[model samples]
Target: MCGIVGAVAQRNITPILIEGLLRLEYRGYDSAGVAVLAEGNGIQRVRAVGKVIELQNALQATPATGHLGIAHTRWATHGKPAEHNAHPHMSGKLAIVHNGIIENHSPLRKKLIELGYQFTSETDTEVVAHLIAHYYSESHDLLDAFRTALGELHGAYALALMHEDQPETLYCARMGSPLVIGQGSDEHYIGSDPLALLQVTDRFRYLEEGDHARLTINTCEIWDRDNLSVDRPLTRYEHAAHSLEKGEYRHYMLKEIFEQPQAIRDTLAGIVGDDHVLTAILGPDAETRLVDIANIHIVACGTSYHAGLVARYWIEDQAGIPCTVEVASEYRYRTVVVPDNTLLITISQSGETADTLAALRFAKDQGYLATLAICNVAGSSLVREADWRLLTHAGPEIGVASTKAFTTQLVALLWLTTALAQVRGKPADQIAANVKALKDLPAIIEQALTLEPRITTLAERFANKHHALFLGRGTHYPIAMEGALKLKEISYIHAEAYAAGELKHGPLALVDEDMPVVSVAPSDALLEKLKSNLEEVRARGGQLITFACETIDQTNDSNHEIINLPFVEGCISPILYTIPLQLLSYHVALVKGTDVDKPRNLAKSVTVE
Candidate 1:
């Protein structure tokens, strides 16, 4: 999980490269560096140990002017976060910035050492620079050198290379990681994501797997796996400018939290209409294929995996389908049984999550009936590789601790469940009722946002607690897990979640007055049983913070605090309940004085294994 950007422009491109790196800092911030091919000098490089601002300050002290440059903000996969391991690794004739892991670097390093090459950094990226330099020494062609270096490399990577001999051109390659080429009037840009290039141009071309490109000032030439020239169509993204701004909010995380209403509405716009009618967005043949599906296998990672867990409940309850949710990293490494007519569904916010992408490819090889990707990005690898796709219109989620992306993914999963239910011959009235409940989500979420003041006060109680426990049951059990994840992610607190009933088995022993217990007590059939579980916690003198619907009875006990949420009918409780939990984590992180947006030791996207 790192950010890489390269630009070839007619004018000096140092500022553009720096700005792009600043925008992409959320992806990674352990270390930062930039390599430029100066007009007179062969190559000038600047590196820093932490943050883009450090790199910016270093650049100010020693300025480097160039028409072409490549920059990187690293997440420290191969080495510790240090200046020596920072990216834009240089090797005399060539410099490179790389994202993703080089699994074969150890063997390659041994071979390079045998050839009398010396390394200055502990990063696998340095091996790439030296390899490219060695290849360029042979052919003297930058493009051929890149191709040769790529052939010798193993594992996922998105690389941008610049040669001292070819100062006006940039060579790039992608395999299993994201790389996009932005088209501009007098310049061309390469970035890990489209947001990095939005300041310069909204038009971009997404490079497919095993694609290499050579970019000049105004032209870009793409080569496929066979080394044959290919043309990638340009797409003009409309909302890039607006999505990049924080608007009136103080932080991008808060702005994104408030944007959930619009995000959910945008995701639902074309799929649902008046009178609770559902239109088809999954293509015309989806209904036919869905009806024949016997099972659903959902593979995802992190927050996306929690969303999949919630979807399992919905799909099984609503559509009567046997659904299995697996962590993508675990699923790819194991032998899974795929029965006939099984549907493989992959969920990811970036769609470039390495494990999820690998899991999807594995499922493709198993001959599934159809593959579906529920993701936010339009042209990401998951979307392109899958046979069916649904987009979560959450825009750019800059926060390392995900907020809007998880909620919007829940919304998308709900839609998928409802659609599958209808295709499987569920009653028309029942489907309409579910649609109506879905329609009320935006307003319900808006009401949930108003609970910030209440959640903030709750946060004050949580600030001092070193450990906490979250409890929920039934469909909302996964929501409890998500809440715990959010709390630990931003607040740096130790938190664990359990399915309430399991508390008596082991987690109950950890509950005490000092250990705060947060319970998700929605007004559902399980609410009564959940009340008994709360009593179990209270018996142990544990402090309780409960989120319940307005209809639920308020506890008179002083040790317990109750948060009355807005009444939401049907199975949409998970979506509405997530808002206050997010606010709670945000406020708790604020109280604890931790970095809310970029949490320590975490990256926004997990593009590497």
Candidate 2:
């Protein structure tokens, strides 16, 4: 989940490499470093221990100019976040920046030590530079040395290598993680993402597995590991400039969270026109198969898995389908039977989640339909392998902890459910009513953002609390679990979500007056049961703050605090319920004086599996 960038040009390359690192900051920010090949001198390296801005300030303090350079913003996968553990690691005449884990580095490190190689940092990336230096010492050509060094390495990586001997060129290679080459008139660039090169050029080349590129001022030469020449692939792009803009918010997370209103509008734009409500859901063969499905297997990882859990409730209640939600990491190992007419659906933000991709392949091998992926990225592996696909219009989620992507997944799954119900001969009136309610959801979510202040105030009380419990039932059970995940992920708090009914089975014993219980008590068919569950917590001396549609004034309750919400249908409750929880986790982390943007031990993308 680190960021990688390199540029080869006749002119000085410091500015371009810096800008590219800024654009790729979302992928990583724990540490940053840059290496430039100076004209007369050897490779010059600079590194810092904070964000890219920190590195920028350091560069201003002591800057270097060169025609060839490589840079990285590290995410701390292999070692601690130390200045020495930062990227642009150098060994003798070579300097390199790398992404992904070297799974066999411990053994490889011992082997290198035996071969008389010394190390200055606790990182897997350093091993590569040392090995290349070892190879370059024996072999004359640096490009062949890089290929040979890579062949000896194990695990996934995207590497950018620069050396004093090869001052005019920058060498790059990719295995599991993403790396792309951008085409410009006078220069060719390699970066972790398109945004890094969007301002430089619209023309690009997609790097393939076992592919390596040697870039220069006016040309790019691609090759396989065996040194066989390869051709550059065609370009692909997005709304590059608009995406680069921060728009109106302070942080990208807040901006994306607020953009949900418009995002939801865009998602529902064509679903209801002059004629039909679920028209957008009708794909080529999707309607026919969905109507006749005997069961649905929803596979995803992390945040996407929470969305799948919500869909499990929706599809089963509305479309009369039995649904199973499985974690993609564990799905392949279990020997499960696929019933006839079963629909296997995979959900991913990038559509490149390694385990999810493997799970889709496993399902395909079992002779089920390839798969259907609900993904944001258009050309990702899961999307390409799927038999059918639904594209989520959430744009780009730069933040590691998801905000808009989860909401749009729920929206799309609901629409898909409504369409399938109609095809299954459900009353047209019921489907129309659900669509109308969904159309009104964006405004309700806008109103929900107003709860930020109250959530902030509540966050103060829980900042010192080391442990917490979240509770919900029915459609919102998954939301409670997701809320717990956000807090634990970003706030570093120990949190757990129980199915409300399960609290007394064992978890209730952990509750005391000091421990807070956050409850998602949205009105539903199971509301009475959930209300009873809340009363049990109150009886056991648990401090309670709840998100609910029921009135605090009407309840006459003196012990517990309630955050009242606008009345929305049970199916739509999770959408609105998520806002306050997100704000709660955000403010709690702020109050605890923890890093809210990039939490410790977590990366934006889990590319290495």
Candidate 3:
């Protein structure tokens, strides 16, 4: 994800702009830049190839001061992570910062080159500056030029622009990307995330799709999608800004991992009971929609997709409905066949994930009974667009690898499973058992975290290992995939996960004394099959580490190490098994000396395709 922040204020706003960029550093970026309309310096800019701190250092060396400015943390979508390719891409007297892909930039750049516009950087964002500036030259009105330029754009973007002539105003626009306005005393700000502006102002207004605005010290005029002036409702953000800090933890990833128990407890606080899950947790009319009998379709990306995969098992086994999960990017690009009463569900942590949002938009036209958004951000575009929503109350997940968020999403999915089970005439005894397990989830996860010291010792063995295999059966298969993903993401280790049954088919050949294999052996019906698979690995001299049910008779030998998990049944087992896997990755990444919070080449929120 890319970060964008802009401000027009009464005092020199350089401090405000840089502070916003500092807060947005967690989104992950390889380059940073800022542009300010200096008194006589006509849109001065400072750029750096790596880290927002480098940009801050350069800004201190060569001060770029103005009452108005724009700053960005670029994640390298259209160009390399070079100073020239950093954001605040300028053309003539105009400078702009952008966050999303420009699909038509190639053709637009060609047209501008033929029109005598010289390109200085290999960025699609620069093409946008030239396009806007070219229009500005003719219209002489910034908004008019912006309006004309917006007509030709063919992709997602959240833009902040400043022209030399518009010294007192900042131009902003949002299309398919997230942008919010921060209101303050005689000053206004725009940030891609509300957290970025918390230091200056908590009062914010989320820009709707196709919303464009011109901001000055005392005014923020927003145009609706229909080009008519409108007022978006204001939100006074109350979530603690201090939650972003790591506190006593060595890394944010560790802090988030330890926070999982509380996160799961919060997620199940009101929705679960002693014996059954409240169906109304989906919505007041949830059962009204659930009564319609058919299968379900789940769409998501990355970690969210793994949550969907786990949900397929619960929804199918408990609710007796066919659940199909698809990656949102691929799902959006193809023709989908929706069966009757097929409810479309999209999972996202940010809820601003570009492809997931696009897929949700596409699913709307597919004749689904209703749309449900399993999201973290209550105000995100996905929640607003969906017919129903179930928030994964995992709080703020600053880590790029996603620890608490993934588990909380599973908790939310369990809630959905019980709701569907009740309405679909599933066994009352089974529904009660599922809910009873969920109620004990917080304590189970807390016990699971106790294995951290043991996992830390086990992770040391993996620090030097280059390749590993993960094996699981049934719902735990997705948990194994998630474990593999977490390892690859933060540890930079090459890991592959497979269904335990698929061992003889291919993955077993790569196993040897040097190859470390991680397995999730829950005491489900597939335990016998998983045991046979583990025997295959042991016979091949594969180094083995397993998170197992305590009931499984196991002894740690030279090749096998077992970390016992608190036993649980039904839908809650996968959620419990996920805890040890998370700690394993965290400690492995710790041993590998990688940036656990913001891993290389990854962002916490994937706001762009």
Q: lDDT of candidate 2?
A: 0.80
**Model 3, range 252-286, lDDT digits (tens) per residue?**
88888888887776566445544666554454456
- How many angstroms is residue 601 displaced in model 1 relative to the true structure, after the best TM-score fit? 1.0
lDDT of 1: 0.86
Work out the TM-score per prediction: 0.62, 0.60, 0.62
Q: Per-model C-alpha lDDT, please?
A: 0.86, 0.80, 0.86
Report the lDDT tens digits of candidate 1 across residue range 401-488. Answer: 8888998899889888888888777898888888888878999899888989888888999868999999999988999999999999
Report residue 65 deviation for candidate 1 (angstroms).
Answer: 40
Task: Supply the TM-score for candidate 2.
Answer: 0.60
- TM-score ranking from best candidate downward: 1, 3, 2
True-vs-predicted CA distance for residue 501, candidate 1, Å: 0.6
lDDT of 3 at 460: 92
Error of 2 at 207 (Å): 39
Query: Candidate 3, which ten residues in sequence have the lowest lDDT sum?
Result: 276-285
- Answer with 2 or 3, whichever has the higher lDDT: 3
